[model samples]
Target: MGELIVIRHAQASFGSDDYDRLSDLGHQQAELVGAALRDMGWVPDRLITGTLARQKQTLRGMGFDKAPEEHAGWNEYDFHDLLRVKFGGTIPDPVQHDRKTHFRTLRDVLREWQGGGVEGARETWTQFSARIASARQAATREGAERVLVISSGGAIGQLTASALGAAPEQMIALNLQVKNTAISRFIFTPRAFFLHEFNATPHFAPKERAHLLSYS
Candidate 1:
């Protein structure tokens, strides 16, 4: 049996030209998560991250000094590109930097992408799922007792939804609620994989850090 901990990257610069970079608060969130892991005395046998700046930076900010192995399969779907493909020059600019509008747009984008609206996207839903499954298989084959992965909310949400046998809509809802730097734990045996927890934020439990609990 082995334990797999998946962490969604910290806050990204929403409404910015470059969303791949983490915001200042995102750094704090990553540090808090790292502190929590340290307090738990967890030392992962292996660390992995998606090929994204925010994902790598989040791991680094968490005080993980050693370079983590990059997995392209862990990369998130390109939301901006998807939007363009879906709307064909009709995609609206983020309205007023409003969180509600931003998320609504994201949901629409995902819905379109899932429905095959995106052109030249790296992977379809089937392909994406298979790729992630392969990644998991490879990680388990490494024979580590504990493994840490840093990725994006969409990938984590899809994985969780698949594990729970949820519908596509359910996955979208789950994706929306996943907090930045939140940890989801899974227990895996040779025969089965069990989700022990999802979207847990023990590090920022106090009221003040409540704002740190954001998915996007």
Candidate 2:
């Protein structure tokens, strides 16, 4: 058996011009996560990340300088694009920055996208699940004892849900719980993969690093 550590990218510049870039606090979050890993004496035998800029930047901020094996399978659905597809040209600009409105919009967008509302979207839920499964299979086949993956919440959530035999709605719930730079762990064997933990934020425990928490 081997261990798979999945990390969600740190907080991006949400509601800003560039949503794919990390915020200042996000950099600090990444550094703290890296330091926590170092403190725990954890070093990955293999590293993987999605093609997204935030994903790559989070890994770099965590002090893993060398380029990771990039995989499009780990990429997230484009929420903005999906919204455009669902609402056509009527989508309103995100001006309020209210957390409730932001997440409400995200949820509605995801629901619509999952229901085949998005046009020109590359992957469906089924296709996305299969790709992530294939990625996991390939990674485990390499016989690495410890592997680290930096990916988005949706990908990680779907992978975890599939591994645990959860329903699609459960997967969506799991995705929502994932915090920026949070870690989820899995124990993998040749025959199966078991989730050990999900959405863990020990790197920024409230008592120790309260200042590091940032939703956006």
| Candidate 1, 1-216: lDDT as tens digits | 899999999998987878899999999999999999989999888899988999999999999776688887777766666665666745576532677887888787677666766666656766776777777776666468988999888788887887787887677888888899999998888888878999999988999888777767
Score residue 199 of candidate 1 by CA lDDT.
96
Please provide, for model 2 over 32-97, each residue's C-alpha lDDT reduced to its tens digit, 9 standing for 90 to 100.
888888888989888898899999999998987555898888887666666665666545765225
User: How high is the CA lDDT of each candidate model?
Assistant: 0.82, 0.80
- lDDT of the structure predicted as candidate 1: 0.82
Q: Kindly report which residue stretches of model 2 are placed more than 4 angstroms away from their true locations once superposed.
A: 95-97, 206-208
RMSD (Å) per prediction: 1.9, 1.9
Best by lDDT: 1
